[model samples]
Target: MPSMKQVTFRDLWQRFAELVHENKSVLNDLDAAIGDADHGSNMDRGLEKAVEALNASPEGSLRADAKLIGMTLMSTVGGASGALWGSGMLKFAAALPDAPEVTWADFVNALGAFVEALSKRGQAVAGDKTMMDVFLPAMVEIQAQLSDEESLPASMVRLADQAKAWSDGTRDLVAKRGRAAYLGERSAGHIDPGSLSSAFWFEALAGAVGQQ
Candidate 1:
């Protein structure tokens, strides 16, 4: 979700920044045991670079924004999630040529592109305990909710609801892709950090969508 009638590069950066700001500590805690202990730092750094890139160009072109996101994440963040998530955004951004005003179809295509790109890059799917666990199902719900929507805020709230469900659903899933997979059934007790983060981003977007 975005505030403006036409989403600019700045809006994308702001959405990401707001999510990161809110979740930095949570992500750091989540990464402490299962992962490298730098998820928050890495994502914050990546988004900072993304904003810098946004400022560098400031052209409001979707393509430019996409390329900057791709480059920034690839350069700043490490590990599987960084590459996969970064590439997903990049792939979606690449599909648009200019500062095109997006519609429901655009979000659908963008989410589909994200899952497809991450699948191709990571070879994972829903229930894999990866970000795809949340992304795939949420995307499905988003498409269904927005298939006939006229108000952007309404569709975004629907998307947020689905994302919340996806985040909650991750609690019972066993990790199959990341190092957490080694925990086997033990992973089932803890919520997937990636899904939580993804849902937070959606929540922030939804909160901001109607603000303007």
Candidate 2:
């Protein structure tokens, strides 16, 4: 069994930057089908700024780094995505401990806080064809697996897999929130860009943690 790795906030941000940059076009394509086609570029730019913010004022604790990322995204990213994502990041930051390395419970609690923040910000629930569709269920699975005493990488991989399934499930859901709701039944076939991007975030984290 692989030993648990200590994941720093810097590691999380760097991995997010790389993954979002690499998959920007794919996210844009998904968005183009259902909503504004700028999700990819906007997220990429925001994450890039987040990386810069972290580098400029290196924080010894994960909480500080997460706050910097949240603020940077809120100020730099465009569209509603910026507000929602930034709010979620801020909530995650608030939930984290002052320590540099995060334990499994700390990570799970942070994610739970993020989900709650996002749900409140977007006023979205499950099957809303929103990122919460992916987030809510993924968090459940992550919480469940927390009892297994598995290595962090293994647990993250499972969560990423669950997130992917939930993201894909968004394809069949009619939009109940956001601009996509304007299309009503017409939105059923297209994948939700937000949910997909959220999945990418988890996948990137899993990949980053696995490498360690």
Candidate 3:
């Protein structure tokens, strides 16, 4: 029932949760280097609960779905990732139309709100070796591609690659936020687990959009 022009909120989150599950070990390994080795486990647990909540909920409004995801992540996920994703998703839910589906423009606008919330809450920027490294650049690319009138599915493919590249770029940055920051220069050689998971988030979007 999905179209190329629009994506259902349910499909999006489900795909994201799937991607995280598939890459759980990789994420945990990445986190092991610079922080506590629980990023993968925590996110996987949280997203699984979020998906279960989505499946159980009767209402299908976009805002409701997003808010449910936010609250579920907040309650289930632990540490900074939980707080950032949970609170940011609340902002995302608030920015959305209370409908079953939304146009690509609406999705992008809501995503911008989510990114802004993350930026404000995490206080991390492009060079901080955090999730923002991927998110900030992805936002710029998404907006630019939107303005160019590119199809969502195609643009999402490119965005997924760009997200991974941005996440890769974090390897050399000294961590300025989160538990990794405690390691100082030692964090420089490792990728941020949050950024890797963020890449999976974009990859999931690409998969959902492509399937549509």
Q: Indicate which candidate wins on TM-score.
A: 3
Candidates sorted by lDDT, descending order? 3, 2, 1
| Candidate 3 off by > 4 Å | 1-7, 147-150
Which scores higher on lDDT, 1 or 3? 3
1-212 per-residue lDDT for model 2 (tens digits): 23222344477668878888998999899888889888899999999998988888854777888888889999989687899889888999899887777777787899899999988889999999999998888888877776544477787887888888889999999999988998999999999988988898888778777776
Tens digits of per-residue lDDT for model 3, 135-159: 9999999877774334667878989
Error of 1 at 186 (Å): 1.9
Candidate 1 per-residue lDDT over residues 104-163, each given as its tens digit = 466567668878898899887788877787788777776666534247677777787788
Runs of candidate 1 with Cα error greater than 4 angstroms are 1-9, 147-150
Question: What are the root-mean-square deviations of the candidates from the true structure over C-alphas?
Answer: 2.7, 2.3, 2.3
User: TM-score of each candidate?
Assistant: 0.87, 0.92, 0.94
Q: Please list the C-alpha lDDT of all candidates, in the order they appear.
A: 0.72, 0.84, 0.89
Q: What TM-score does model 2 achieve against the real structure?
A: 0.92
lDDT of 1: 0.72
Q: Report residue 28 deviation for candidate 2 (angstroms).
A: 1.1
lDDT, model 2, position 195: 93
**Position 126, candidate 2: lDDT:** 96
